[model samples]
Target chain A: MLHELQSGFMAAVLTGSQTELTSVTPKIREGKLNTAQRVAIYRRNVQSTLRGALGDIFPTTRWMLGDDKFLNVGDQFILHAPSTSGDLNQFGRSFPEFLSAMQPSAAADMAALDWAWHEAFHAAEQAALDLSRLGAVPAEQHAALVFQLHPSARLIGSAYPLLELWQAHQNSEEAPLEISKILPADHHFLAVHRDDANVTLTPLSAPQFHFLKICAEHQPLGEAAEAAFALDANFALQAFLIQTVQQNIVIDFNEPS
Target chain B: MSPHHQSSRPPHALDPLCAGIGLRPPHYQALLGKPAAVGFLEIHSENFFGAGGPPRRYLDKFREDYAISAHGVGLSLGSADRLNPAHLENLKKLIDWLQPSLVSDHLCWVGVNGRYLNDLLPIPYTEESLKHVASHIRQTQDYLSRQMLVENVSSYLEFADSTIPEWDFLREVAQQTGCGILLDVNNIYVNSINHGFDAMQYLDAMQGADIGEIHLAGFQDTGEILIDTHGAAVSDAVWALYASAINRFGAIPTLIEWDTDIPTLDVLLAEAEKANVMLEQASFAMPTREGRRHAT
Candidate 1:
């Protein structure tokens, strides 16, 4: 009886659906205090709490859409998707996908990119790249150096001017944002990494994106070089490795066979 | 190392009689240089789950000065799915890093069916639910290699199939498993009022020795239903219950918890000072021949 009442109570709280709390020791009547009024408190709490979590996770998306529209969208997300972890940081893992299917928006792809950036920011940390280990590789292998991006590094490809959208929405005071006259363009590559304890994004060339993606898979330099070459044969492996190592994005490296 | 050698003796903090307050962000800067009189500080473990940040930085410094407790909200231990190894791993890391005096989580499931309610929903006090929660707590203790406390949450409704009283279910869970009780006094008061039970009766049913800590917080009364909002000042009713809890349990390390509309640092410290006074009065006062003295 305890299980039935509590489960029914939660169901009513979660969906605002009517549930009779029978089998309780005193048998609670829905009409005892007007079931709708009784259940409204929990429903308000659940929705408000979830909306606050979504606001934290998708601040950029919220900024792109005005507060009222964003809340409207939030209500839809809450009704359609239920959070799977008590951690609010994990609340929006599916939000990018949700954006992909939501009602038409001029900046839908940009919203997806922003959500991805938030994920990378809170990702687990890794030790910086060890230069001593790289020294152990033969001096002859320097030209073929392939480096591993930290587990937190992510690559986002989007067709909208997401970088501009993200830049305008930053907590900093910038010139007024003008998304008016913008249209979706060809897919652009973006490199997202946590540096100085803050997640940052930089535009990447096709070759640069593929190269990091390959190295991120722990592929050795030689194989990763071939993949990079497929995109742009003129890809400079040495220069790329130097830049990546300096950025603290590359944490470890392996020899290519 | 052998299992015996690997296991460190349970951490030693203040005696259970001490009263403390939750250290929140608003209080962080002020607490840094000030002298702390409270017994300990309890923080939500998930608030510091991420890598290095201000929360970790402040907690590290604070732990050095005060006994600390890591109270968790996201373990979801009672779910049908296996305990989340990742969540446990993060908790273990925090435990190792901070070396808190006590660790605890709710006695209810917040996530299931691939959806997390992100709120503590009550468990049916049936043998089946008990077994599931007990095994999960046992496994969590083994993995963390420490005895953790499980807290009873405020629930809006009771389950129909529950076979035992809520207090008995809680006490038995502690007895059957070696896990301790967090014993949130405010929750007891809230549940008692919501369910039409005597709060003192619930306290009497608990094993005082098994309680590792106590929690005091404020709740919002919506007339029709009381919500454990953790906002505003501790109500007179909850304070009365706190006095009762301290009398029965002999001052188990109490905590003043305020999470929403968090007031100024001075305001929180003032609240903590009030709890300290109550603890002192409860300890010094003699138990009358007619049971405990009702505080004036």
Candidate 2:
């Protein structure tokens, strides 16, 4: 009896179709509330719960799109996506992707950037770089050295002036901020990490960015350095490496080729 | 590292007699060097779901001084999809590392297809949901190789198609799965008030032996609705219901949860102290009533 009832109720909740309820059990309508109303309540509850998750993950995106439209997108996301975790903290991984494909008036790139940044904020904590190993390496092999970014670090590049735009939006009420002054035609690199229990983001240079990327890929030291140089010939390998090392951005090291 | 290494397992710190508080970020610093006595601490497992960081580091220090319970918020036990393997792996890792006294999750599903709602959404109290939830719980226990306490969530709505009462559904789940019950007395009280069910009757229907833990938290009576916000002190009426619960299930390990609008650590400790007093009174208050009733 328990099995039969759970299946029928799940069927109704899953499909939101009156026919499913009737087919599973005719007694669904016998309660104080009709089957439709009960199922509607569940539907409302489910959507609202999903909405709350999206709101948390994409606060900026929701702010960009009005609440009503944000809710409409939320409803669509719920229909397309079902929750997989019991934890609300883990709920919005796919939301940025959902917003990218969504027809909302906001720029897709802006939404995607916001989502990436949010993920970096919630990403796991890891130990800072090991300085002793890298310091032992010979200066002659410095160019061959590649740096590994912390596991929690993420590098995001956006075509839109997303970094500047995001900053401008935050300062909108206090004073009018202009993105045109800071906007660059070339892509801008952003590094994300948790510092002091807070997620921090800062722009990165070509050498620093590529070096970390290669290390993240776990490419050996020699190969990672080559990649960094490929991104920019004047990569200033020593200068950036010193700054990254001091910042404790690298968690581990390898032999200088 | 595998969780089954017996030598590495941490000893349990939970005391059967005292009350504990759920540890949150707001109170981390306050709890760091406090001399006050707290039975143990419980945390939302997902809060430390990240691979490593300050949260894990702080929890490690806290565990050294206080017993810990890992209460999970994301193990969607009732979902029909095969249990999430990634989620299971993460949980397994946490249990192995933390070695908490009690590992618990809700008897609810928040995700339907793939995206997670993150809230403890209601599961229909029908045999199908029951069997599915039970089998999932059994599998979870088998994987973890430990009995998990499944807590009931507060629900604002019930399915018109639900064939069994919520308590019965809960009972069948615990009985069939061989999992212990983490009875959230506050949730029961809130549901009872919202759904117009007799809280005592619900308590009467439960199997006392299977109950492993009790949760007490305040609710939001938003005038139009009663939400289980867990944001304030437990209400007077809810405390009465809790006192009744103690009469039925003597001296279960109780936790005071304050998630939103969380107050000071002292305030939570004070609230937990209140639960401890009630817990003591319940045990002492019981034999007298039992003897009087038998005299009749």
Candidate 3:
């Protein structure tokens, strides 16, 4: 009976429908506030809490869409895809996909980048690889070594200039550029990672992005370099490797067994 | 229950009479630059569920000076469905890491049927619900191998099928599970107003309860009902109630919890100082229990 009441209360809160309240309303005491009013308060709290979680993660998207539009979209998404986890941090993983389906716009791309930045901010902290260790490996064995990206590193390729969009929204005083006015790139690659206390977004060229992507997939250094070379004849593997290692993106490496 | 593994680290002790504040992100830098004058810092355990990040880094930094309280908001201990193992695992990880002076969550459910509403939803005060919550609390204490404080939540409505008083229900759950009570004085005041019960009566009933910690927070008055928003300053009435709680419970570790529209470190510390004043004025001294354990 308690389970039945909880199910009914949940339905009443989620659906906000009178029909769903038949089982719940009778079970609620009639005080200064009627059962409907009392249930409505809970419904509001649930919606606002979920919306606040989304808003916190995707502030750039919220700024792009403005408060009213964002709230409307957030309300719909709350009903469409209710949170499965008790942790609010894990609530909006599918929000960008939902937005992509709802409207194929740059805002959806921005939401994806926001999600990436959020993940990077909260991902496990791993130590950057010591270049000396790489130097110690025999030059011949280096080809077989599989490099790994930092646990917090995420590679995102988008059609929109997400890094610039996110940066533009950082300063609340500055007016946001119109999405139509901003030029969309054919392919924009980015490396999102947490450096110490801040989350940083570094733009990447196609070859560089692919190289890191390959490494992230656990490919050997030689294979990743070859893939990068295939994209561009002069991919500059050594220079890029040094840059990534310095940036603390490539955190560790494993030798071939 | 024996700890799954004993922590070699020494326990961080908190003064039972001193007040503390909730550690929010905005005041991290400020708190770190110059540690606030408080006994401990309370953090919502779920916020640091991530493997590692700035939160964990800052918490570690704060831990050096202050005792930490791993207060959880997502355990859903009162839900009819079975407790979530993943949530329990994450909570255990945080507790093991922080080894907080106190760990607590609401005496209410946040979700059921695997879908989290993410709000402190009230539960009916029935024999069935009491047994369910008590069992979950027991399981949680066993899993974590430590005592946990369960706090009362403010509710706008009451259940028609409830067969027990709220105070009796909370007391019975603690008695059944051997869990300590984290009495939120503000909630008692809010619930008293909304449900037309005497606030002093609720405190009177909890006189002998294992009051491990006290929560002092602000609430929003919607004219018709009081909402535990925890945004504004703690009201004079709630302060009065907190003083009464301190007098009754004998200087329990108090925390000034501000979750939304969080103010600067100074403002929170000021509120904590207010609670500290009350704590200092207490004439009685209840024998403080160190890590209230669950009965095996």
Q: Pick the candidate with the highest lDDT.
A: 3
TM-score of each: 0.85, 0.81, 0.94
- Cα lDDT tens digits for candidate 3, B212-248: 8888899999988898999999999999888777666
lDDT of 1 by residue, B127-207 (tens): 888888899999999999999999999977664456788898899889988999999888998888777889888888998
iRMSD values, candidates in order: 5.7, 5.3, 3.5
Scored against the true structure, residue B220 in model 1 reaches a CA lDDT of 89
lDDT minimum window of 10 residues, candidate 3 chain B: B287-296
**Each prediction's Cα lDDT score?**
0.74, 0.72, 0.85
Q: Return the lDDT, model 3, position A10.
A: 90
Q: Residue A143 of model 2: what lDDT?
A: 54
Instruction: Enumerate the chain B TM-scores of all models.
Output: 0.90, 0.92, 0.93
Using DockQ, rank the candidates from best to worst: 3, 2, 1
Give stretches of model 1 more than 4 Å off.
A1-12, A18-38, A103-107, A130-136, A142-146, A171-181, A226-237, B1-12, B15-18, B23-30, B33-38, B51-58, B77-82, B286-296
Query: How would you encode candidate 1's per-residue C-alpha lDDT over A11-91 as one tens digit per residue?
Result: 656766543422232433343354455456557877888899888778777777767877987887787878866676677
- Candidate 3 or 1, higher TM-score: 3
